[model samples]
Target: MTESPLTIPIYDGSLVSVRSTGSSMTKAQLTTGLARRKAEPEPKWKSGELPSKYQCPSCSNYLRFPVQFEDCGHYVCSSCLPDIMRVASRCPTCQVPISKDKLVNDKTLQKDIQSLEVYCTNKDKGCDWDGTLRDFPVHFETCGFISVDCLNGCGAKFEKRFMNKHQKDDCPKRTVSCEFCKTSIIFEDEIPHLNVCTEFKIPCPNQCSTEEYPRGKMQDHLENDCTKQESPCPFNECGCEYRGHRPDIEKHMKEAPGIHLNMAGKTIALQKKLLQLYEERSNEQKNWIEILARKVNGLEKNYGAQYIWKIDHYSERLQEARSNKKTTLFSPPFSTSRHGYRLALSICLCGDGKAKGKNVSLFICICRGDYDSLLTWPFSHRVTFTLLDQCEDPDNRRHITYAVKPNVCKENRPFLGRPITDRNASFGAQKFTDLDAMSTLEYIKDDTIYIKVEIDNEEMVPI
Candidate 1:
């Protein structure tokens, strides 16, 4: 072997005392010796021959950390020394008498064995790595030519380079499951098969105990087959508090008619009286709201009313709304004074009357405030709704203006007003704007839309 010249540093300074330095010294010695030997040029090899001199005489394998007998210079591998001593109290190579107590470590031979350049075992299999015998373990760990078994224990081996691909795409025994439908499948063809796994389990939206019901049958099962579902009784108007599975309730009703009839008569009379009270309260609330609204409007006309209303994530709000045919949202009530009459802006999607579904209906309605007792009676205002244009273009900004007539008719006013009248009223455009108009105008951006409603100072006119 061609060797690199060894360089040693000489210390002229006195050594300082240390509590622990044995580990550092041993590491430094190993590192320096290995580096010197690794710098040597590789040796040429003849067929089936090596330059290792410390070979075991018994099996003829290369000796590592050879042990020498103290009495003689003959050396043998420490691994085989035990077996040799058991057979006879002699060295296998020299037949010299030996014992465990008489054997000493042969450091010189260990250095030679560590310096011998060896080819990787996979060199014949296209690996070209060359390193000292001491480094063979590390080289073998990351060698590309080295074979690895399937992680799933499929008994198939692949080169380290192709092992990942084999497990993810080629290995038939690899365990995999669909992401969307969660059906177990083999890795091979898992992607294509997942797109058509029709029988995958999905949750019943009605939250039935059958958690893994088939996806395609969910609607039908919830509507007709689910036994745990609750429904109103057939004798609903008879003040029955029982809500349970429909079939059992129907059976109970069919068996007892006289009892149910008597219950129904008393139930109707009580319901009528309750309804009448609700109507009366509702009327009082309407009158209170009307009085408060008129007071706020009158104050706004006297002192300028400036308010900005913002509704964000307009699209998400629409999607979350439970009503498929109609839905309405109301703004927080605002007043012209600290405790003056209050009014709120309302928008009904899918409309309420003739303009239903196709248009966005806007309204300004009365809200009862604390200062209603000190306010006026009749409520009226010219309300204007502005659909803000989020885009750079000015043409998209559209305004819907309405002229609201004052409730001078006594029957048309609410009972809560100072001069209490028996009615409820609001002012707005039934078809303020169409859905198509809002979309084409690009009124909503980033899933958000803005609406600006203000009381117009102009005098009210007939509709």
Candidate 2:
């Protein structure tokens, strides 16, 4: 006779047969048993004690499936008999030879064991289940206190009663689709995904009349479409200070032409005044530079006692004098000796006093000198003036020359004495040369005239 497989009741009330091998259950059977029991609450013995007759002889545990040996009339738990038979082919208690055909189901012992009362293993965690062993497995499968993994594979464990709630409301791996973009994402990542959703609507931050726009189009609206944005007047650089909304500014330009014109005119006037001030300052700086250059030139010519005065823009100077813009021009100062009297030459281009309009007038002025105290008063020095000719042949050139000796008398003291001011009054020829003589000669060439002034050092009076 073939040995019968031990059968156990599962959650669905279907019987699963457990076939044993030499010393263990088959892997597939072991796995199925573990999986079924993994979903159930663990059981606890609630009855005072289990009777020894219902316990397995090999394992000493309460019998799950009791089996009898015909040869020895001995009983053992079906769960433990495979291990016992693998060691020896005999009843573990009576030493009688045993075989697969000699084993039979002990239904009487099983009935007695099933009647034992037990409590739910989760009783310590607030479960109050207490029932006969026959009902324990079924109740455990449906127990609200049983802990199980989330069905969504989110790796969270909670009571079976809360499984539905966690999967529906709180599981991080639960699939959710965005309401605006309709993109699918996990529940926990929904908020971050919405932050970049292109289709999401947002109100304009500028608080313009437009209510809202798609997030991706909001910047374009603010820059190009908003009429309520403030802008400066188109004529702002012309001194118009008006600033307003786009529509209001358009209206302002159309209504305020006279005001803008006045502003522009005033701006032009202010610029002209600033230009005039700049020119005056420039002229003053030029004068100071000329003075400094003259000082440096005087030092270079200390022992020479002669100066070549170059008059440039001859035609311009003549026209200015004729127009009364300027009448006289002075040469830079010179000295009689290295430490002697300082003097300067002056010319009236259009003539002066008795020579007016007929000839050019020339004069000499006594300028204050550093060594004046060591020189005699009523300055008596023989001075000479020469106007250069531009003729190529020096032999044929006729350079106009004139000499003068200052009269040492009280009447001419102001012109001959040591200067008490920047210079004593100029005194010299009223008609140095006629205008017609100058025009006929090479005295003026390339719009330039050169005049030479020299002090006769041999005749210079000393203290």
Candidate 3:
């Protein structure tokens, strides 16, 4: 987009023609217009030339609004007369004593000075303007070569041709807007203004939507104005889903007491039933885990305890299992301690995709151990599984990690001991890393790879 030029309007509207550069009159035409009516002697002086009598003795310039000395009748330009007295009380040319009181307006000389034609002071700079002294001021106003100070106060000067470019692209004083607050400020001050502008946008604290509101008014809006904000029912916990502006919701609760009480009663009843079901499921999972723990404990005593396990030649094993030719491969049972939880890792070559297996699924499971009731019912451990690369230190590691989901409530959980999730949820490549990506994983070495499970007591694994 092109920027408009900065033009100061000419005070004398008649000067508008100063902008035109085209010539309608030729030199010959102009000469004929000023020619004598009949053959006559050539004059000693041209129209614009000042006769010697009209020159200022002090300044040696064409006399303007000449002031005559009453005693000597000598004319001096009004401007030079002032300085002439400063240098000496006598007239510069005649050496006659002169003073301001003896000076009087010389109308004849003034008229002559005004009629003299002169070239514009800017003509050398490419302006072809020509006019009498009386019209010089008007022509100068619109001269293209005249320089102007920057309108934006940037301490720069520009000619008409470059004025718009400087103001639009280079002036530091130009106006700009702050990105965060949308406030207008000078270009140089934009960054600093944004740093302190209080109007920057912020999201509603109630999370009603992604739309943002101005930071300055957010608190008041959230406290008394937001519509999506929720408030407790007058009859607390009435299972009401009706949320609205604070004032409207409050009015509803007060006017609808009877309806609210009925809702409150039903909500309480449902909550109680939910608690009962949760207790029943919790007891069931506790008993089941206890049984498995006992069996695991007896087996461990017979076979030395192991806390880490490995599966070798993974690709081959997956292919075999997928053929319905033994799908489940079990890891040697392991425990963190004799009395701690007994767990095992399990894998299936045929994925549940039922495509007849193109993937692998892994799981962590609970095994019956000796310390059943005496130990923690729901195991809480951070499990990290590493698929070890056959290569050296840095290049040989790929991790598949999961935090064992606690039996928060047996009734609600998908299965026990974190149920190892589904093929899509827990250990499947689709869940941890895509199967195709796993094929390129650095950890798979030779046809064999090792898996390690470590427990971090300090980290609480999130579901």
Candidate 4:
């Protein structure tokens, strides 16, 4: 073959014969040929860079293998074909009228354009894929994007992508059970159906909830959250499950408690068999209270007088000793007295009748001074000071005071006066002068009272 195309020897592991032929060129020759082809001038095509990187304005997507109108410079991504055919059937850039079939399709160019597509902008939203311009719209509609579901108690999930906007508007998964009625509905429908459910459980009419509520706990269940519920009698604590209604509750009180009192109505009865039994108990309590009270006209006439007697028998003895003059230290014979301080006095009135008129006026005069009620008040004894009768005689002037003194002796902290001041004056200001009988009782006095304590010291303006 014409000198065998001038064979040359090459080393490719072993010696091999290489030849240059018109059909089979040498490596350098093939490379030189390619270079020459690249450097050669290519005839200018009618559309330079035709069907390249044009993007659709409507979709904001890269146009692969752009389709051009026959008469216009306007180009569009092939991916937006169906959309562009509808309203904008003309070339967008050149404003030329177009028919759907007039646009060109370049399959070879489209393949090249396809290689240029990239990952979707929404890839981070739980999508994991890439696509070409012509195929990306379909992929986006199906891509699973994780988003919060509108349903109550529904956990977060990757929902179907296409319905994102639609699910937000008409999603059935966004429903919740109502607290009042326990009915299921969309959260937005809650306000509408709040009063709709007929079988909804609500609080009972008579009482508060106790236990296993909305079943038996009614309005009479004692307005408390932690109240002991109406449970089976603890006669046997093995969870006696016999829960009873509130009205008949007393029948199930703990087996036996020594003291029993029943309130049938206005009368509180200390019930027992014998009238003497009632008398004995009341007398015992009466003795306990009289320990502090000045023995006066029929004091032991109220309830629980016997219980007080048992509490303060010794105090009663000391009081009786002082009264009988049997104790030598308590009352000194012919004791001489000298006043060391001045006593302050003032009068105020509080009346339920609210009358400033003397008829309904509550008259109060307090002998205020250095000597304490501890020493002076007991002289009146553990007693209540209350209005007994209004003095009608203008001459007597002093409001008539009567009281069932120490009437609340059963309660150690019984009220002793109306609006009692929680203060005691104990400063030693004035020095002693008199040592015997001529010493007058010195008292410091004030007459004004305040409606509220926060106001600055009030000036007593004369009327």
Q: How does each model score on TM-score?
A: 0.34, 0.39, 0.31, 0.24
Clashing pairs in 2: none
The Cα RMSD of model 4 versus the native structure comes to 29.8
**C-alpha positional error of residue 206 in candidate 3 after TM-score superposition, expressed in Å:** 21
Candidate 3 similarity to native, TM-score:
0.31
Candidate 2 residues 160-268, lDDT tens each? 9898789878999998899988888998888888788787888777688658788788878866777877778977987778888878988999999899888889888
Alpha carbon deviation, residue 457, candidate 2 (Å): 99
Cα-based lDDT for every prediction: 0.62, 0.76, 0.59, 0.36
Model 1 per-residue lDDT tens digits across residues 1-463: 1111221111122121122211222212211222233333232232356644656675465654466677776766544554566567687767888655555555567777777778877777788888787787687788887788888777898888788888887888787887756777777668567556666567766566756766667767876767666777667667666677757767777877888888888988998999999999999999999999999767656553434567776776565443653377777877644544577777776565777767888776667666666755565555567777777767755554444544557665652243322223455778888777767656777777777766644453311
- The regions of model 2 sitting more than 4 angstroms off are 1-42, 57-61, 70-74, 87-98, 175-184, 203-212, 216-224, 227-463
Which candidate achieves the best lDDT against the true structure?
A: 2
Scanning candidate 4 in windows of ten residues, the lowest lDDT window is 448-457
* Model 4 lDDT on a 0 to 1 scale: 0.36
For TM-score, candidate 1 versus 2, the one ahead is 2
Task: List the candidate 1 regions with Cα displacement exceeding 4 Å.
Answer: 1-48, 70-72, 173-175, 179-463
- 2 or 3, which is superior by lDDT? 2
Error of 1 at 127 (Å): 0.7
lDDT string for model 4 (1-463, tens) is 1111333112122211222222432221111122232332222112333233444444443443345555664555544444445556666666678765355544444456555555654565545676555466466555566343444344444465644554565554566788866777886677667655554445544434432334334333443442444434433233233455433344655432222212222122323445668799899989878864744312322211111001123234334443543221111111001211112211112111222112212111222334333232311222222221123454553322222223324232223232145322211111111112111221101221111001011121111
Candidate order by lDDT, highest to lowest? 2, 1, 3, 4
Question: Which window of ten consecutive residues has the lowest lDDT sum in model 2?
Answer: 25-34
